[model samples]
Target: MTLRTKYLEPWIQARENLERRDWLSKDKEKEETQTLIDKVYNALGSISWSANIRGFSNTERTVTLATYCTDEWLSDIQENQMLDLLQRRLQHEPGGQQIKVESVYFYILLKRGYDARHFTCIWETRHALSSGLGPSCIGFLVNVNRNHWVAVIVNFNSRSILYGDSLNQEPPNDMLAILHWWMHHHTGHRFTTRSLEITYQKDAFSCGLLSFNALAHHFLPMEYPLIAVSNVRNGRLKILLDIIDQHLDQAGVRHLQGRTLLTSLFDRASSPSVKNISSPSLNPKPLLTLCDQKVLYLPKARLG
Candidate 1:
């Protein structure tokens, strides 16, 4: 379905109609509708699945799936903060409509995706990276003119960015250029960039899921790069749902397969064993082998 045709056609008619009408709600509706039109027009290149997930209610955890992964589900700069708070608070409190608050959904999606034409959306992304614990690969999510989510990784240590789009269009030149300028101006950090060969994202709304998956895998890599290249390059919805489940666990997210997903990924990548590696991006593939048909031998490869 062409969102441009579906969304713009009616919107154009509405705008024309509104020019002559004098209704009280006309201005407000027009503002909201125009925002939607702009957002759709601005983000038309890939798949995005941020706001589409429905979740269980606190009062009705077993049945209804009405909650969103992010509260606002639009876009905002404060989204990461919101997500952090929700995870911390819910881990101890448990049971609340608390999950309904907005975070990464609006901050990253709506503002950066729709508003980049007017201002520097890349600033928030950069700040978010600098605020992290170390010089690391940061996921730079953005939208284009076709309404899809694209994933880029700003590798501070390598001084480069890896641009990956679900739709496989040309690299997001504007976004990368802005990011390059941001890094250079703020920290004198120069960067080279390359396009990454990626798997499928042909569906309409898979962009958000794909974007989230890219970041998640980096922070929670599998036993092998090949494994990720196979199992997760597609079937993103399941992984996305698992991530939401990881967040909803009020007992606090457990360390899985040795340590927490993010911890293990980062630690295993930086350990002394693999410390001599050129790029953390290409270090140890999770060593995987099969025994009898009984169990799977999946070992986390620490830095060599």
Candidate 2:
């Protein structure tokens, strides 16, 4: 049977209206909402969490995900922290121990005058390279001057860098050169750079998710599904849930489960438009394997 536009239009409209509006309580007073928020914050205990997650402060996590509870561009700090969390998740997955995820800060440090030699020092301090922990695959989420985000995967087995950009654009030449130089300097071999044909994001804010999914697909394909424009809202919710799940301890999880307010709040906030419609199946097109090799050269301009 042919699909009916009449039946599908509202669903499409609902996806477009992705922002959650009912964050505050609708009852006589907003006491319930405030209480729930406080509970979440208390469980998080930002000071201790920051010490554990390196630098991802409590305020950064709660403010970014709690305020809107909707699709939004991840901030630099959020993305980096999320990357660290994802790396933890990946390592636990079967066969994921072979993969290593580089911090977004690595790229940031390079941008701030660090060189290939500095990476050698960094790897030493992190105890990644010094301890004979040779990962077959390495993932990098590069932030291009706070303008755009991209994922670059260094596959040691293939001796290649797989580039993923949701905007269907090439990574800047200088950035590629830096990566190329880093690989050759550390491993003593030139690695080929190739682009991955990832699904193009239809909206602006989903770049972070897309870049993240690129790494997710490479390391833990079955666990973390690929997301594009169609299911990006659900994607956002899934990520939020994952973050909350990872940080919450058994006691905290039980505390959250004991209350209905938090669940109700998430339900109300996430399903703003479509109350009855189930989420669409997220089947994405197969990524094209054929892509031109990107030959890079070190730029004359020095790192700054």
Candidate 3:
């Protein structure tokens, strides 16, 4: 049987069945929902039997799933942080309800008798009947032995509801591309690239999509050429190095020439003594001293 047929279809049908039943109270409904979620996870665990068969155990694995509910669903609650903002929306405003669920599954897959933990996020698509626009969710698959994780964010909203095929447009920013390029350039491990779906509403930003990677996560700044690239991209190469210099100075990574130049420039700009030595002849001694110290010097005269 196909993976989806074996795994997802049954789980989805079970969830649908649970949702169709009328519960006495909201608490009971919530409990039923939780039970359905548990059942789905358990079914998923069974379907992913290879994960356990390969010396991988549930003791070292954990999955976290965060579900974002629609405004209408949220309004049913007595008090919520997002309630006030939802109430003030104009009537014409798209009242479509969307639930985005992001799940990060961490697995400890053994390699050569050594245990390794990997993290992955997965995406799932679900639609609410009240809101015509379908919702997208995230899912993850982690392989600890491979030191890799895969994350997928599915976008289920109709093209008209979103950006009318703008969702399929090429990326405007080069950040992820540059990051991927630099990663492969240095590590020699061909990093697979995928685009994540991100959504913005007014001032709020949400990660509606994600790209999956099959390599261990590395600290971005620690990678050399990439760090340089990022610094240049942020227009902070000079400033960052300067700050690093200051830090290094505090850490005793002192360069005497740099320190001297900096201090001399600062003193020349701020010192009161420079004001007193302004006159060419009256304070010739101080002027000469300044010249001797190389604090003040004239440029070479150009011949016409």
Candidate 4:
């Protein structure tokens, strides 16, 4: 097919359905976005952990299950769900990484809250913020208003920040200031600001999903901009929520005490020399490197 037929024609088709592209009339989009927000809040509240992923299945060992999430559980949770379809459409899904956003440690971390303090603990792996290359993407959720959320993405690899708010307002300076400090302090890099790929939100409640949108798609393997907006509009945000829920669901699957040494999993994948989670008396190797940023040597016993 010709380039116009392949590229230009599709944009025309998508543009015709601006609502699908989230280019809707202001009032109408607000109505639809609010409805989506309500559904998401309910979905998040009602999600259940599958027995298989929840450590109830002898067929699946708990410890290894901590490492691998079954698609069976994924399929169930995402059936007719927003996240299910996003996974189906995402051009680049994470693979080869032993740890995931849905690991037990991750949920525990989330349960407590996600803030700058846990940066090292929450995102210190190749699969995390890192592009599996030298570059990395950090998705920051900031509450600029007392109740409204704003999503900010810092791409260290590109030294750029992509900010999004459905309200179409600029992100607060105080939030950006803190994020700037955190990025420099945590990863030792600086990033500049850029307009988000799509800045419009359907309404107020969408900040949560909208921010997640920034983070979730940062790793998309598609071409520059890696835009997945059009496909997810029109109450299609369950995709983002399901990603978090799936991880939490997987986290719920770990056996009591079997949930130990979650950090060791990332350490193991990051550097072969690192120690295993202390279980069955794990004997860790000397710490050689913590990704491309730093290096150190710690006793195998101290890895946990």
What is the per-residue lDDT of model 4 for residues 10-55, given as tens digits with 9 covering 90 to 100?
A: 2222212322322233674666654554444333233221122221
Top-scoring candidate (lDDT): 2
Q: Cα RMSD to native, each candidate?
A: 23.9, 17.3, 29.2, 22.5
lDDT of 3: 0.25
Q: List candidate 3 segments past 4 Å from native.
A: 1-99, 106-146, 158-194, 197-304
- What are the per-residue Cα lDDT tens digits for candidate 3 across 157-189? 321111111124443233234323333332344
Q: Alpha-carbon error at 82 in model 2, in Å? A: 3.1
Better of 2 and 4 by TM-score: 2
Q: In angstroms, how far off is 100's CA in candidate 4?
A: 9.0
User: Which pairs of residues clash in candidate 4, taking residues 3 or more apart in a chain or in different chains?
Assistant: 54-253, 82-239, 83-238, 83-239, 102-247, 166-201, 275-284
Candidate 4: clashing residue pairs, number: 7
Candidate 1 per-residue lDDT over residues 1-304, each given as its tens digit: 5532332233222222222221222554555433432332222111111122223222222101111211112122222322343344333543322222223443344245444543354456545556753334445456566456665666666777777676777775566566676667656778888765455554455555455455434433451131233332123223323334543454243323332222222122222332333345432222101011111222323100
Of 3 and 4, the candidate ahead on lDDT is 4
lDDT of 1 at 223: 15
Instruction: Report the CA-based lDDT of candidate 2 relative to the real structure.
Output: 0.55
lDDT of each: 0.38, 0.55, 0.25, 0.39
Off by over 4 Å in 1: 1-134, 223-237, 240-244, 251-304
Which has the greatest TM-score?
Answer: 2
Better of 1 and 4 by TM-score: 1
TM-score of every prediction relative to native: 0.40, 0.63, 0.17, 0.38
* Candidates 1 and 2 compared by TM-score, better number: 2
